[model samples]
Target: MDILHIVGQQRLEGTVSISGSKQSAIPCLAAALLTDQTVVLEGVPEIGDVATMIEILETLGAVVTRQGDMVTIDPSRVESMPLTGAETRKLRGSIYLMSVLAARFKQGVVGLPGGYAIGPRPIDLHIKALERLGVSVRNEQGVHYMRVDRLVGNRIYLDLPSFGATISALLVAVFAEGTTVIENAAYDPEVIDVSTMLTNMGASVKGAGTDEIRIKGVSQLSGCRHTLIPDRMEAGTFLTMGAALGRVTVDNVIPLHLESVIQKLERYGALIEATDDSVTATFQEAKPVDIRVFHYGGFPSDLQPVISAALLQAKGASIVVDKLYPQRFRHVQELRRLNARITHEDASIIIRGGETLLGTEIEAPDPRGGAALVLAGLLASGETTLHHAEVLDQSYERFDQKLKELGALVWRETI
Candidate 1:
């Protein structure tokens, strides 16, 4: 097993580059399955989720090649392979491939959605959207079997603005017979990113990053080269690290995409300077603040764990609430193991500031939990050993290495 040995009380300085968006890359790769040409993607981060998507594509007969940050996916020789239960069960993103396969081959069999158990992410919305697009969806055991001869586009009103359901709607609607309208859609930037790529590939998409989206089906889509947006989630984590422990300049990021996180950091007495492409943060005496996570354009639930970890040094009490993931207090438990004063109440995490955290052996429950544990380690004075650190590779690209580049004392060990 892989573990992280972090020597605490060491401040970080210098610059760190953010990687590509994992959110955009997954749907874009699924879009590639709609075409027969070679779809080239630039700035695709090398993460475990992406690697799993690539492996899934290859199993379905897509030719994939990777050179650094560029990925070339050729679906010219694609076939309808029975996506085994063990295969699609690797990650929740694998669920998107089900619609892509059904759209291409008229039928598909994929296992149920699986991945980080951060919250209740039911796939009922995905199935509902697919069925609305004229696809007959059935569940036998834990696998979903979808078959559709012709996808008839229609109006889809989602109960909630789910990111996965929005992507699935776009996937099935692109090759549909007529126009498809998605109301109460996800307003995330990744939705716009996927829409832009689909438009470049000869599909008609409009009103992305809004409550409503319109998609006009095309006869066929050709492959096109697309560039991914920066990973704001990764950028936010690094920014929290800088404001909590040391000074760090995070580069290769989109400032507007991080407005929510930046505002919170600045309110916490961190000196923040953001340009068009980078943000530099300097830590000072912290001021406690309440953090509430909502949908896009609001504080992201994904950053709740890491930001809560940073609030430990504040002078007073801080409340971190993630309504989207009520059980996201796994990091709070791990931080308590290191002698931090924190409590979880339903969807809220109450953090008592000014606690001297001591380093000890801990484990990460998930990817973002791993980031929070690492941040807690930075506040500790001794050696902090973090097991199951491999979960960090799921979303973050060279995270510990980036911290090391910014002068953090960290080492990766196999024990």
Candidate 2:
């Protein structure tokens, strides 16, 4: 495993253009398998999960050419095959391939997904949605096999608004026989991005940024080039880092997508300015404030940990409630290893400020959590060693280089 050695007590100030959304890119790559034309994807992030998707596509016989940040997929030579269990177990986004394979071949097999050990992320919602669309789903030998002789659209109501389930349904419903209505769907920006990609590919999809989505079955989908929306999560993470260290402006980002995060930062007394495609966050002198995190349409649960790290340098105690993944506070213990005053009780974390963090060796529990650890290390005193630093490759593209460019004393040391 690779480790990152970061020297702290430096202000990160620069214009950093965030990478493409990894959450959006993986689903778009899987959806590319629905058509047998040359699909060119621009602004794709060079991440481990994206690399896994490319490997999965190539295993199914698609000709994939990756040059710089552009990925070209030629699916004319793709053959119908089940994704291996080992490959499927590497990333949660692999489950989205089930819908893509079902749409193209009408039969697909995928194993249970395994990513971060955050919490119980079951695919029951996905299976139920697929079954509603006239697809036969079965769990055999730890693999999910889905077969549908003919996909007929119907009224599908999700028990919960799961992003993965919503995207899966959209991918399969585009080629169904009739109109498919998704009730209580996820309205995240990534969902809208996938819907936008589908619409650009000649599929009729509407109500992307709302709780309900409707898709009209198309006989076929054509090849189209679309640039992915900037990663809101990445932008939020960087903004939180800036709020912790110094004033920084994150460019090439869609500010509208970050309203929830921006509002939360403002509530915590950070000066945030938003434009059409960029957001600048400045913290002249950080003041501690209490915050309550909610679900989507509110403050996202992903930003809670990063925000917690920033609050460590504040003036008061801040309480963060994580309603989505309660166990995401595992990184709190790791952060405390660096002399942060954070204590977890139930689903909320109490962060007391005015403690100087001392750098120490820590492991990245997950992707987002690992990012929080890295940001804390950047602002800590002395040298900080982060194990399992490769976890950042799942999202951020060239994180070390970017941090170095922004005046962070970070370097990659292979062991």
Candidate 3:
């Protein structure tokens, strides 16, 4: 295992370019398997989850090559096979392989996925959506075996707007026989990026950033080069870090995707300047503000932890209501370990600021939560040692290096 040694009480300053979206890269890589030709993906982050996905692809006979931030995959010789149970249980996103393989081949098998144990996240939505597309799915002792003679597209009305299910549906629907309409689909920006990649590859997909997504299956998809969109969550995390610590300019990010986060930070007394593709966040001092979070098109649930960090140093109490992912407050315990005064009741967290935080040993519960802990560590007093720091690698690219460049005393050490 590896631990991160972080020296606290340092003001962060520097311009850091955000990495590509890990959420977008995973499904896009799986989408490449639908085509026999080589697909060149630029700006792909070199992260643990992505590396695992690439390894899964290689095990299925896809010739994959990596050069810096670029990944090239040739799936001409790829075959459908069951992913190893161990590998499948490593990351939740690995379950997406089921839809891709099932769409490409007549039969596919994969075990249940596992990632950070924040709460129970079942794949029933995925299975239900797959069944709607004519795929017969069966689960035996935690392993999912699926078979589909032919995929004939049909209207799929998701019970809830799930990002994973929407992406999985898009992956399989791109190669199906007829038009597939996904009603009440997730309209996340990552979904838009995947739909854009598919459209470039001759797959007719429209209404990606809306509730209704329509996919017109093409007979064959040609290989095409595509660059992934900037990671909004990564951009938001740094923005929140700047709000908590000091004035920091984050470059190479799309400003529009961060509108909700930037607005929330602005409400919390952070100065934000947005350009076409970059956002600069500067904090003079922490000011107290009331934050009310709603559903999508409002404050997102992913930024809740870092937002809570910002509120920790504020002048008054800040109320955060997470309409989505009510159980995402696992980071609150870790924040409390650093001396933050936070009280949680139901789906809301009330933060009372003006409390000085002292660093201590803590563990990251998940990727975003790990990021919030790192931000808290950077702003706390004394040294903070973070165990299981590898969890941060699941998303952020060169996270420690970026933090170090911003004058943070953070280093990775093996234990």
Could you tell me which 10 consecutive residues in candidate 3 have the lowest summed lDDT?
Answer: 288-297
Please write out the lDDT profile of model 1 over residues 1-415, one tens digit for every residue.
7999999999989899889999999889988999999999999999999999999999989999999999999899999888875657868899898889878778998888788878888889989999999899989998788899789889999999999999999998998999999999998999999999999999999999899999999888999999999999999999999999889998999899999999999999899999989998899868998999998898998899999989998979999988898877788888998998998888998899888989999999999999999999988889899999999999999988898999889999887
The numbered model that scores best in TM-score is 1
Clashing pairs in model 3?
Answer: none
- Report the C-alpha displacement of residue 139, candidate 3, in angstroms: 1.3
Candidate 2 C-alpha lDDT tens digits along 108-148: 88888777777678888998888888789889877988899
Per-model TM values vs. the true structure: 0.98, 0.97, 0.96
Number of backbone clashes in candidate 1: 0
Tens digits of per-residue lDDT for model 3, 1-415: 6799889888888888988888899999989998899999998999988998898889889999999999999999999888866777887888888988888886898988887665557789899889888889999998889999888899999888888999999988987888999999999888999999988889999899999999987778889999998888888998888877887788889888888888878877888887887888888678766655544577777778778777888868888887566788889999999999989998788899989989999998888888888888877889998888988888889999999898888999987
The lowest-lDDT stretch of 10 consecutive residues in candidate 1 is: 81-90
RMSD of each: 0.9, 1.3, 1.6
Q: Candidate 2: which stretches are off by over 4 Å?
A: none
Residue 225, candidate 1: alpha-carbon lDDT: 98
